[model samples]
Target: MNVSQSADTVWNNPVGRLLTLLVGGGLVAGVLTIYPQLLPVVRWVVPVSLVFWGASRLYRYGVADSLSLAAGCLLMLGGFTYASYLLISMGELAGTVAQLVPVVGIFVEMFAAHYRNQG
Candidate 1:
């Protein structure tokens, strides 16, 4: 292969994939280090984030079924977390509903918009 093609192959290969993962991981580490207070909320948020993250990854990998499952799980977690305060104050139902609002509202709207454009 020519030098240009060789370089292009490496750039698109597994090593390059690892490098991107490492860089993104480092950025997350740095952010957490700078904002330790995020730990608790992050625990809850990560799963929700992963829901979309996993969904997108699955979609990219041609795994729509997996994305659908993960998305459902994510929405459930979001509702629970969102209603945390309500759970503490008003009891279970209200707090849970609150969590659902933010999670469902944001993800669903974005998801709908995404698919709408495809059609």
Candidate 2:
């Protein structure tokens, strides 16, 4: 039943959505200021954060929500692969994953929250 959530409320998720907006705003602004060429990609940054956010969401959230997270992860992986192809080598994929330290940490924390709630 999606618990207490409503259709309009999905986008307004408190923790992840809010943080994604704040950080994503800054990221988009910086992209616009520094590299106008990347303006198009600015839309991508927030959604990726949302992906990690949703991944961390309670399983009660919904099966579709979980699917969204998987799709988001796949999108991110594809994006990384494409970028690597253009300007990075396969060897550098390892380094790129390393650069995802903060992301991994956030995801881990979210999972911790998920498990803690379960127990």
Candidate 3:
């Protein structure tokens, strides 16, 4: 209703929900990665998810009028791209961390929004 609320909504994106889903799927794929039979699945999922996640962040923030958000998205994409490299070299743990970190970020964002709303 107010200008502040409208601005807050602008920064919000359904990408958070998609991010959460990817995290969950990544966890499942991670467990599968441990099995010799499932190694093929892991190989495919890791790179694909990395690309998808990066693009999602860019698309979510780049469309907004906020330059800061676009910058943040670019930074996140850089970190995420590096982490994807770690995923392949460092094995399942690295991949799992890469996937889960964004989920933590999403929660942090949610908490910040909640606190700001309270204030």
Candidate 4:
């Protein structure tokens, strides 16, 4: 194959998508680490974004084929609830997990979209 086609093929695959997610997550983490003050913004942004995304999907497609959208909302809610519980009763690990939940949800949604497009 030509160089352009080879590049497109690499980026269109699951592994490349995963790698992109990891790199994006890592960049966000690094930036947050550098500017700890942005934590509050991130906390709000994540949940709000999740809600908006879920709402948009529900509005556009309904639940029939958007299980992942519902799951993403649930993941966000569950993560935040658990994080809050942990913070009140335990510690920082919960906060870390809360941050990670949306990332995992995003990966799930991405794969779902990929497969849906294929099928």
Best by lDDT: 4
Candidate 2 residues lying further than 4 Å off, grouped into runs, are 1-91
Cα lDDT tens digits, model 2, 1-119, are 57457534755778757776888888868879998888656545544554455444434343455443444454445445444443545466675663454355446546644755775
lDDT of each: 0.60, 0.54, 0.57, 0.68
Best by TM-score: 4
Give the per-residue lDDT digits (tens) of candidate 3, residues 1-119.
99878656654757755666788888877787667687766556544564465466456646453443444344455457545655457667766676666555455445544554675
Ranking by TM-score: 4, 1, 3, 2
**Shift of residue 115 alpha carbon in model 2, Å:** 1.5
Name model 3 segments beyond 4 Å from true.
1-90
**Per-residue lDDT value at 84 in model 4:** 63
Q: Model 4: residues >4 Å from true position, as ranges?
A: 1-43, 75-90
Candidate 3 versus the native: TM-score? 0.33
Candidate 2 or 4, higher lDDT? Answer: 4
Q: Candidate 1 has what TM-score?
A: 0.36
TM for candidate 4 is: 0.46
State the displacement of the C-alpha of residue 56, model 4, in Å, after optimal TM-score superposition.
1.7
